[model samples]
Target: MTFRPVKATSEGQFTIEGAGVNLYRAFGFHKPREFDPFLLFDDFRNDDPKKFEKGFPWHPHRGIETITYVLDGEVEHGDSLGNKGVLGKGSVQWMTAGSGIMHQEMPRGNAAGQMHGFQLWANLPSSLKMTAPRYQDIQGSDIPEIIDDDGTKVKIVTGSFWGKRGPVDGIAADPLYLDVSVPPNTRKVLPVDTYANTFAYIFAGSASFRDASTPYGVRVEKEVNGEEVNIRDMSGNRTLVNFDTGNEIVVNSGPDGVRFLLISGQPIKEPVAWHGPIVMNTREELMQAFNELNNGTFIKDQRDH
Candidate 1:
């Protein structure tokens, strides 16, 4: 099996979004080729309720599909489409801002006054850019989780793995979204579509997207679970590992284990004319979208005859 090499790595940067919600932006606004069809990934995990209480107020979006996964707390949301709901712990919301839509997401902390969540934006092919807006609200219990013999667990969110299908489907990008956790020192090989652009984002412990060229093996002077230990080619928390073309990936967990969100998607290689949340094919089209928004005509008919 061909193990895809690590194309690039980044520790991301801290930012504030949605009023005052502190967030760490993994990758967004720019993913030229290898990460095509996927635009943004924001990790909004915070313990301070004041940091997130302001939450995202009213916002407008077009030409993109946003996926929100809540690990703790709840988000009360309402959209111009007349949809309103609460996305509680472990819940997922896949909202397509096709044509145009205005929405607000208000986050309320859990009983312990903590909140954690992620927001990912996937680009749409030009053909489906102006399709009707849609929403896929998946509960935490409804999402399927598979466990392996070595205590490896995978929470399938939007794609299939090992004969089980994800809950969110019917999309133009055809993506695979998974949450994986491996026990300490465990090594696992996972298959990914050779053609899809894939990435793994480490959130909890440390892991090595180990290949033959990786430089990790013995223990080092690193603190782990109250002890100093070794980490073999381990990528620590809040890091993003993007892979090159191959059918599979290999990972080695550190002493504290590793938990991450792995995602892949088919690329849309067309010209991208982007302005804020509105993405189109040409610069002229982008201007048209904003001009319409200013003229109060942003929402399109979206009804196919």
Candidate 2:
């Protein structure tokens, strides 16, 4: 019953993307290998429509998969393959940019100009790097949610949790993605694969991770009767909690409760050569991708017109 510890903490900083849309990037474009099988994560949650309405224009992606989960508002997307659709609230779009594909995502608020969503980039192994592109759009209603007697609600987005399987499957990494919420002062221990790399991103409220010996620069909080007795005062939003080799994760919520995304996956354990939306095994492959782009051959398969 080993517990995962907090490896590092990063504040979601202000950033601009998608035709100048304002947002925060939790991790991306730098330190590309902090977490294996996971490259980038962006939080595009905003209250101002002008800040995010322009949205991400037609962009090309290759050798990776992009998972977009919307919490509030609708994201209308269309691809060069002639695939077009809108992802309403709580819907998720898992797109595999195998060879290459150009697409655009435009966000429209749900009445109050409030848009909230997250986009996470998962790295594909070298074997599947150039596979055919695909898309799996799962609506909120289709996703299964589990509620515990202790007031903990878990929305399983990918993989299985609490004996229920998620809709998004056939992923190379076999990741477990869950949106978890725990009531104030409640403690919960979530099962995780012993071999997978696990992490949690706190988006709302505060919580204390396992009460193990803190890392060199990490502050520790003492516990009494299985509760955080000496709560630290420095916790903030967007904190990244990295766990060691463990089978379960323990979390204790603060007064306002805690809401976070718990994600874990099997590491690729290979060298990564990343450039923008494309990620490959070496620089030569990256160069080849760019060459194809310049030669107008990036999109390997053109969907039936």
Clashes of each: 2, 0
> What's the residue-level lDDT of 42 in candidate 1?
90
The top-ranked prediction according to TM-score is 1
Can you tell me which runs of candidate 2 are displaced by over 4 Å? 212-230, 302-305
Q: lDDT per residue, candidate 2, 1-305, as tens digits?
A: 76665666667888998797888887887765667889988888888999999999999999899999999999999998889999999999999988789999999888988999999999999998888889999999999999999999999999999999999998998999999999986767888998787778888888877554432123436867887654443344777677777787878777788899999999998888988878999999999999998999899863322
TM-score for each of the candidates:
0.93, 0.91
Q: What would the TM-score be for candidate 2 when compared with the true structure?
A: 0.91
**lDDT of model 1 at residue 25?**
92
Candidate 1 is scored at a TM of: 0.93
Predictions in order: lDDT: 0.88, 0.85
> Candidate 1, after superposition: displacement of residue 52 in Å?
1.1
Q: List the lowest-lDDT window of 10 residues for candidate 1.
A: 210-219
Q: Cα deviation of 16 in candidate 2 (Å)?
A: 0.6
